[model samples]
Target: MKLNKAFTLIFLSFYSFSKLLAQTDETYLFPINPGNKNYLAGTMGELRSSHFHAGIDIKTGGQEGLPVYATKRGYISRIKVSTSGYGNALYMLHPDGNTSVYAHLREFSDEIAKYVRAAQYENKTYEIELFPDPYEFAFQRGDVIAKSGNTGGSTGPHLHFEIRDEQQRVLNPLHYGFDEIKDNIAPIAQRLAVRPININSRVENRFDRKDYYLSRYGVNYAINDTITAFGKIGIELLGHDKLDGAANQNGISTIEVFVNDEKYHSQIIDVMSFSLMRDIIVHYPYDIKVNKGRTYHNLYVDNGNRLNFYESKANNGYLNIEADSTYHIEIKMYDPYGNISTVTLNIKGKAPAKQIKERIDFELDRISYQVEKNILKVFTRENCEEDANKELSIYINDSIKTVLPAYFLNNVAVYLWDLHEGIPTSVLSCNKGVNISINARAIPHQATVINAENFIVNFPQSALYDTIYVSTAYEVRTQDSLEVFSIEPVTVPLKSSFYVSASPQFSHYQKDKTHVYQTDDAGNFSFVGGSWSGETIQFNHRSMGEFTLVTDDTPPVIRPATEKNYYYISDNLSGIASYTASLNGEWIMMRYEPKLRLVWIEWPEGMQNKRGNFELKVKDNAGNETIYTTKL
Candidate 1:
């Protein structure tokens, strides 16, 4: 009775604490080491000129195998081991129903280590993913689970710790409890830009058509020659600030912009959802021709980007400033620990100078022109082309038809007008490049076929190794032969299977009389040219190799494998076997989640096992069926 009462009170206390966390106004707390002695290699919310940094990086004394302890008490939930990404990661579920993740570990504790090693051996693979039940491995406060290490995407040794909600949305660790970090440094404002109100427009340099440094505290620039503007205009400023103890210039966490005391935009890095990762591009500008480089400006407008951090009322988070309007702009920047920095700007607007117009033959049109390495690509949609004339000394290459995004550009990054438009979607140069590998995964509507007659390529530079686009294009044959030719790069061998499309429509018979099939638009293909017989058939690709195909024609070969010893009186359901298909002949890992009462399959990139029919022509050594299909 006493134990029951104690358990009830504990549950009630936890429930109340959870409610408080939900109701709190603070978004995140610090999760730093107890002492603020460590320096940062990367900072949360810092501008990368490309992708957004997802989590806070705490320095680990510049070495691996640093003892890492749980930030809070919780039960072991998920443990994933991989060569890339978080190296070896661990997840602990707290009493408050939240999960704390510790990634890139050098090793696990003895108890957990043994369990994982056994699992790895059973699976016969170095990489493994598993979810343990609530009581599988529980840890109290400061219980050591793993040691921090530099693994998978880490250039140095550091601890990658994150806190996530029930739905797996990663919240900023600074919100939980780390208040020890001191950041008194102010944010440095690099440059202020006045955007032209037209799309595809150009900002005239006071002297030349190129970008020039501004003399501090100077107002109004006079174009040395003629130029024109297009579309809406904004500013791209390059700036970063240092923390109190760390010398690295880290990204600011909070941004608040006010135009004459009116809130124009505000963004706080409280939490992020993984499902919204692609939204990272939408958070920055993508127009490579105008903004010049990939520096993200937070105007907090939702461009259908579920970034999970933006909270805005009007026009997303974009602060659309008008041309020829005098205004006062104030921007407030903050770090995770309430460290603040402010920048104030006073501006006066004027029309394009007459000399600027004469030099560039300035015309306001709807077309957007992007310049890369002296090469220019003009983009014009149905209603996009308008009269806009801007003369700039840029190299022009008319050979390439497509373009890469600015992130891949050399020494240059372009910022577009919209938020989340900053990812590298196109090649940054027009140099000749090699098509490294082929991805045959099937996608809707954009499937490529092998033996294509024409290939469409958008090379970013004249020198190879820039970025190469390899896709097969089709053309008609005069003799009705339906022959498809190769359009891939010159270096890609014409007969290489990577250039081959995996679509069933492009299937052909091999010498062995087996049919080869294409997988999808992504170049994932399959071949049933040979029989599965009793042994597992393996498929090989350039990078992905040696996958044993799980044949539905044969039932899953099951042995006397059960969870625990059961003294059942000869029940028919005693030891059931199962088998699943794998794409590109890879292994499909499966398990039945007792808590959810559902069968779960990991890394299933191909067809599924059929339902209900559990008998087949062949059987394993223990008399398991050769082809046994069962419901998931």
Candidate 2:
């Protein structure tokens, strides 16, 4: 069975490699800048917040409504209109077993726009996904299909384009021949980090990671400072790439590391599967990215990172250093167009230190903690002989307590506890206790629960991308009887949504008007409709952050803006849920942009002059309703 499994794996690997080779040979024009008149804003396989950028972003001169063209002759397969994420997008199926996507469109072409508008009226919703017949909207190659816009989650005016296979695996658009996009600039290796993998391992005589600056020599670079390393170590680099005629930096395609002339590690991000996109959290150092805002690609494979974009030898590129031994390292960063930048380093391994002396300085009011992978690390000041035997009292919510001994570190006694067992609400030691801290340790592919006095969090078995310490607390209650709940470490991404069941502490006078909402940093409330089962209210939350229960007594505001062509409809809380507009008691087609809080009518060709008793009714998420009636 083992041999057969290995054979299957090898065959699949070869088939995938051959499929990629064939994909590159296929031809597609650039979606924007067909004549090479513009530069790209993003590259395929770039690391983006929450997920990998599935495609390329074509710059539109920082303006919207630019004509976007079809790269190849294909038929419309899908169309999506929404208030978020790829607003007004189109998908086409070509003859080459590939699907082309154009997103953030200002408007579709004449015929396509008409079809989409009709669909919206038929469904009576601004957000809709529709599938058209295979040849319903076929067009020739290089034909103008839509106009680009800075809609949805886009920060600026650009067209987000993508090429994917029938299986939905995203392919690099740069692979296809596109003379429009040019790149000759090599990637820049900004900084290098060497990490000690084991307790006894040290880099520069410290158990923590040490970062080095790079000295440039032409297109190549080198680390000028002499480095000392001991025991097992892993490497990471912070680097970026640039294209010709553009100074904006994006993701690099590949990085190859060699130890003394032998290939040890290679990371290539040519293709990424959407099913495994969230694995990005494990691809880089999660703690560093969240706390330091720096993305450093690991030169070594990490735990639970199943991204099929790496190749390495011997323990996934972790170099085990011995006392008095010397090692040479070479790192090469490559762009998709074959431009390369190199960096070199030399390390001398010194004898490992035993019983190292260090001063301790810190308050034990709150235990300092950093969760690296699944291990729960707590830092505390180390004092006298009794401090060496101090153990952390893990206070589980169910009254069970587990004590873990103090581990090693120079200035602090680090308590390294494996969180696979469970998570604790608080950890206590010597007279000091961490309150309302790590609620429970959530492991990927396993269900976990965090029970508290005010609420209980239920994590689905597939809730996590990687093992993380789930933190939750009832931050505070407002005067309006609103309870703000913090379920945090908002930086980590989840594979599945978690369920929150909470008991209400505030007055329930307006029980029927109450619902949960996710609050952003800007104080905007996104209604996450929840249901109450007696005393406990339950809701599904997609992301980790602040959640609150709001009683929205105020109805949606609907006021005339432009006589009859437009209306300003907004809700103070628990945002607008449903709306309807009528001309003389007859339904009319109305278009809306939620982000702008504007609603208007695109009157049918002949209905502009005929207007009577105009009425518009809008409702908020908590069932509050408002109506505006006027005559034209």
TM-scores of all predicted structures = 0.53, 0.83
Name the lDDT value of residue 255 in candidate 2: 94
User: Global CA lDDT of candidate 2, please?
Assistant: 0.80
lDDT of 1 by residue, 510-554 (tens): 222222232333334343222322221212222112111111232
Candidate lDDT values, in order: 0.47, 0.80
Number of backbone collisions per candidate, in order? 108, 1
Q: Which ten residues in a row have the lowest lDDT in candidate 2?
A: 358-367
Q: Which one is best on lDDT?
A: 2
**Per-residue alpha-carbon lDDT of model 2 for 399-439, expressed as tens digits?**
75655544344646666566666666667766566654676
